[model samples]
Target: MTPRIVILGGGSVGMYTALRLQRRLRRGEAHITLIDVDSYMTYQPFLPEAAAGNLEARHVVVSLRRVLPRCTILNGVVDAIDTSRHEVEFRPHKGPPRRIGYDLLVVCPGSVSRTLPIPGLAENGIGFKTIEEAIHLRNHVLGQMDLAESTQDERIRRQALTFVFVGAGFAGVEALAELEDMAHDACRYYPSIEPADLKWYLVEATDRILPEVGPEMGMWTLEQLRHRGIDVRLRTKLESVKDGRVVLDDGSAFDTDTLVWTAGVKPNPVVARSDLPIDGKGRVRATPFLNVEGYDDVFTAGDCAAVPDLTRPGEFTAPNAQHAVRQARVMADNLLATIRGTRRRPYRHAYAGSVASLGLHKGVAQIYGVKLRGALAWLIHRTYHLTKMPTLNRKVRVLLDWTLALFFRRDITALGALTDPRREFEYAARTTAEPVAHV
Candidate 1:
């Protein structure tokens, strides 16, 4: 009988693992099944651009079925993994949860947005994780501008125009910058609102922003954002957001219609229940070879695995796309080696540094100890991600998006209705339809 191989999470690790495995495995050697909540893999780096209208939303996500033709794709959630039985409880969209057995298990469920218990945050704060949120944020931000333009009440207008982002990390900074740039460009169309009327605030609990970049580059990014009239409040905490009223620990308070939460992410909570050896951070503990500690049959990688950083002794690699992609390749090859009874190699790659896009022609980077700023940094940021983006199909689409963007004015159309396409129809059907006589 062929071995049943089950890979969890269609993220960087799971997708690449299955992709590489499908290419190498002979028919009937093993049955490969990959599962994810989302059918498409989001190129997360381009999310800010998609939010800012620099790239079409569809271009930033790759269809899993189209790319992984050789593997079985299951769109659902894994409720639990029972290592003792080599079975996982899977829950499909329209079916009751069921158990699926596997001979080999690979865990790579990615991270979700880390949020806080602050009041009104759950109700008001929007995350920057999925492409859905990105699109909604774009429409919501522009819609706020429209509200400001038409509102008669000054307080409501002010609240609508005020935008507060509660993190200074890459997602928070880039998202704030891109939307701000787009909003500023959009001000020309609003007769009543000027760019200066918009209030943007970035609140960070730490003194520095973009800490993934070196201290120097982080400081440079701070200065750049501040120079653009953005308020960067460091060493501050968001105390509350009750009723759209943002309260900071520093005794400041304000009302805003938009509050973006991009503080950080914890590893997928599923790791905690996987019956695997996980570290203090709730990440699956793994050997340098990317195998679960003391379990040769089980493998893990990407954000969910705490694989050691070989370059830096006694430390784990950062959970970024750079490391995730590299680790996936090594993990996949190691799995092949295990199947072939060959030697498994350890995964090791030095940190290459970080690059972030601030807006259209604005960015920052520190790659291989070389620092870059402004347009040069922005160009490098685009080039690096473009090369890293999976498949020629997506690469060309994203490239053409940029090429066409050069000749086109920004599209500021608010697609808030995309959030609920059936609202109008439902309302029309309820109000205009003839009444039912026999219920």
Candidate 2:
């Protein structure tokens, strides 16, 4: 019987692991299967652009079946992993949970949206982690414009134009910049909606935005956003958001229909249930080789795994796409070496700086001690992600979107009603049909 290998989480780690494993293993020596909740591997870096209308939403995600033709892909969420029995449990859509046995297990279930226990947050604020949320945000932003333009009441117009975003990191900042740019462009068609009336507020409990890009860059971002008339509040916190009324910790209040939560993410909660050793944040503890400590048969990587950062003593690698992709390669190579009964190498890499987009033709990047701003940074940000995008087809589509965007006006049509198309039908059904002569 061939060595059975099962990799969990179909995000960057799972997909890249399959690709690397197929490259290393030849002639069907090992049977490999990839499992994930969704059939598509989302290129998360493009999510902000997808939400902002910079890239077509469809182009940001790659179909798992199309990319992993050689590997068996299981579509579902993994429930539990029983190392004692070499079996894993999963719950597929509309089916009872089932178990599958495997000789080698790779745990890479990615992270989930990390949220706080603030009042009404779960009920009102939307997360920005998935493609669905991205689409919803786009539609919501555009729909708000429509409401603002059509509303006769001043209060309704003000509420419709007010947009609130929490967490000033890459997700919040880029999303705000992109959506603001789109909304500003969209106002050209709505004579009643003035650009000044559109309020874009970014609330952060920190001192600056884009902390991933270092302090200097982060401060620069704060200044740039303020210059653009964005009400960016630093060292402030959200008190409550019940009933669309946003109350800040510093005694501020606002009523807006939009609230975005992109604060951060915690490791998958499943790690705590497993017998695997976990850190304070509920992440599986692993050596730099990506193998779970005390068990060579079990390996882990990506956001869910707490792989030690050899470059920085006493610190684990931060959860980011660059590290995740690089770690996957090391993980695959180490897995191959383990099967061959050879020595395995540890994973070690240094930070390579960060890049962030600020609307059109504007961005910030600091790479290897070199700082770039404006269109150059934006161009670099785009070019780099384009190269890192999963497949040639997706890369082509994303690039084409950018090329077309250069020549075409921004497309900002609010389709919020799409979220519930049956609303109109239900209302139509309830209302008595207009009396008409028999035909």
Candidate 3:
């Protein structure tokens, strides 16, 4: 009987592990199945570019079926993992829930946007995590511009033009920068709306932003944002966003139609439902070798697992794309070794550095004791991500997009209607009727 292996969450870790394992395992010796809520794995590092229309949204995602031809792909959400029975119950995009038993299991369910119980946030705030969110944000920003232009009321226009982004991490910073660039360039098309007319605000609860790039780089980022006319408010918290009115802890209040939330993410909630041991933070506890603690047959990694950082004693690895991609390789190798009855190597990778793009030709990077900023850093940032993007096809497409962008203006067309495409149809169905039966 062929050994059955089940991998959950077809994101960076799951895809990379399946790709590596497929190349090493003998044909017919093992059957590998990958399950994910999305059929494609998004390279999240490029999300800002995707949001800004610098790279087409489709280019940043790798199709699981295309990339892993030898491995079985199940597009579904795992409802529960019953390790006691070595079975996983999942609900597909369609049809009823089903179960699949496996000899070995790997969990890499990834993370979801971490949100707080701020008033009006659920109804008003939007997250900048998934590809859909990125695309929707692009459209939403442009739609706000349209609203501002169409309305004569100062209050309405001001609210429409005001954009508030909470969190100053890479996602929030990069997203705000890229969208501002796009919005500024798009101003040329709108005779009434000057780039300065749009108010952009970046609020952070902490004293600084972009903590991954070091304090110096973070400071530089803050300065750059402020220089671009963005109101960078640090050491501030969002008290409430009740009914489009934003209340800050610093005794400030404003009404804005756009509120972007990119604060951070928590491990997928499904991890807690599993039979595995989860840490206090709701993450699966895994050894340095990527195996679940006290379970040899189960392995976990990526944002869902608290894998001990061997390089830094008494700490788990940071939840980021860099570590997820690298850890996948080690996890696969260790799993293979376990199957082959060989010594398994512990995962050990030093912190290389960080890179972030501000906008089109602006960025900051720190790698190997080398600190770079401005255009050079931007080039390096793009080049590194281009090389890291999943397949050669996607890389070529993304490169072509950048090359075309240099020649053409930014695309600022908003497809806000796409969010509710069925609205018009439903309205028509309600308002209009087919020709009544003839007399």
Per-residue lDDT tens digits for candidate 1, residues 278-365, read: 8888889999999899898999999888989999999999998999888888888888888778999999999999999999999999
Per-candidate local distance difference test: 0.92, 0.88, 0.92
Q: Residue-wise lDDT of candidate 3 within 1-439, one digit each (tens)?
A: 7889999989999999999999999988789999999899999999999999999999999999998999999987899999899999989999999999998899999999899999888999999889999999999999999988888899999999999999999899999999999899889988899989999999999999999888898899889999999999999989899899999999999999989999988889889888899999889999999999999999999998999999899999988888999999999998888788899999988888999999989999999778899999999999998989998999999999999988988888899999999999888888865745778
| Segments of candidate 1 deviating more than 4 angstroms | 433-439
Cα deviation in Å at residue 263, candidate 1? 0.9
Task: Indicate the worst ten consecutive residues by lDDT in candidate 2.
Answer: 428-437
Writing each residue's lDDT as its tens digit, candidate 2 over 1-439 gives 8888999888999889888998789767788888888998898888888988888888999998888788899988777888889888877877898998898899998999889999999999998889999999999988888887777999888988999999998889988998888888888899998778899999999877898888888888888988887999999999999999999988999999999998988887667667788878889989878999888899999999888999999998888888989999998888888777889999999989888889889899999889888899999999999999998999999999999988998788777887998999889878958854698
Each candidate: RMSD to true structure?
1.5, 2.2, 1.5
- Residue 161 Cα positional deviation in candidate 3, in Å, after optimal superposition: 0.7
TM-score of each: 0.98, 0.96, 0.97
